[model samples]
Target: MGQDISQIDSNEIQKMLQKFGKLDEDNSGALSAKEFMQIPELTSNPLVERVIDIFDSDGNGEVDFTEFIRGMNSFASKGDTQYKLRFAFNIYDIGKNKL
Candidate 1:
């Protein structure tokens, strides 16, 4: 079976944070739309903007480390297929925010 994402340890989290740092080009401790687009994984994702919009909880127009990790954790949590789907929907739902 694939490794459980929620089981990721500190080292892995650190690595992810480091990657996030690299993606945050302006050193603003947050990822703006342009910076987010620079990530190869998200390059072709049509919903990248929506995903960032959803995760940018502070309505700051950027995703900070906390919001980033929270969004990641939502995906990482152990769950059945239905639960995972719900999580995805919940995260992807950008309420009251114009995109």
Candidate 2:
């Protein structure tokens, strides 16, 4: 989970920031569940709520810029396989117990 954000291309980071801004409709500097659901890919997913909760690392009920970046980074092709595995495991381990 300690993937370095600096490893991501500057252009990619800028693009992600811009996307995040667009998703933050209320300009609250964080994305609410409604905002997350605005993404078409997530709208139909049965696990959307759990995905959002995982991304909202602080359990603050919203995904802030840092949390958003970290979550996205996990799926980056260059990210560590072990880290990605752990992240994916966490996503499906709804019980909070390693299954």
Candidate 3:
């Protein structure tokens, strides 16, 4: 993720902020796994725990706005195919074992 946070458009930032707000039901300024799972897409995802683990760098069992923004920015970046492929693999191979 060579792209700087400044590179993200203002509109996109606002959009992501809105999403964060929606997910943070308790308004604690962070997303607990229960709150995160509120999203219908994530509700059924088997790897949701790993996804949170990858982004919740502080291990506080919650994802703050900054962490949320950074993770979303990387996911949203329009970068090289190889970079995207590697990211996909990282998500797929969260167990660090051969598939």
What are the Cα lDDT values of the candidates?
A: 0.69, 0.85, 0.73
Flag the better candidate by lDDT, 2 or 3: 2
RMSD of each: 5.9, 1.4, 3.0
Best candidate per lDDT, number? 2
lDDT of 2 by residue, 1-99 (tens): 345676778877898899899999999999999998887778999998988988898899999988888888787787778878988898899997888
TM-score per prediction, in order, is: 0.69, 0.89, 0.74
Model 3 / residue 65 / CA error / Å: 0.8
Candidate 3, residue 56: CA error in Å? 0.7
| lDDT comparison, 1 vs 3, better candidate | 3
The number of residue pairs in model 1 that clash at the backbone is 0
What is the per-residue lDDT of model 1 for residues 19-86, given as tens digits with 9 covering 90 to 100? 78998988999999888788686789888887777668788898887666655555554434554565
The weakest ten consecutive residues by lDDT in model 3 span 79-88
Candidate with best TM-score: 2
Candidate rank order under lDDT:
2, 3, 1
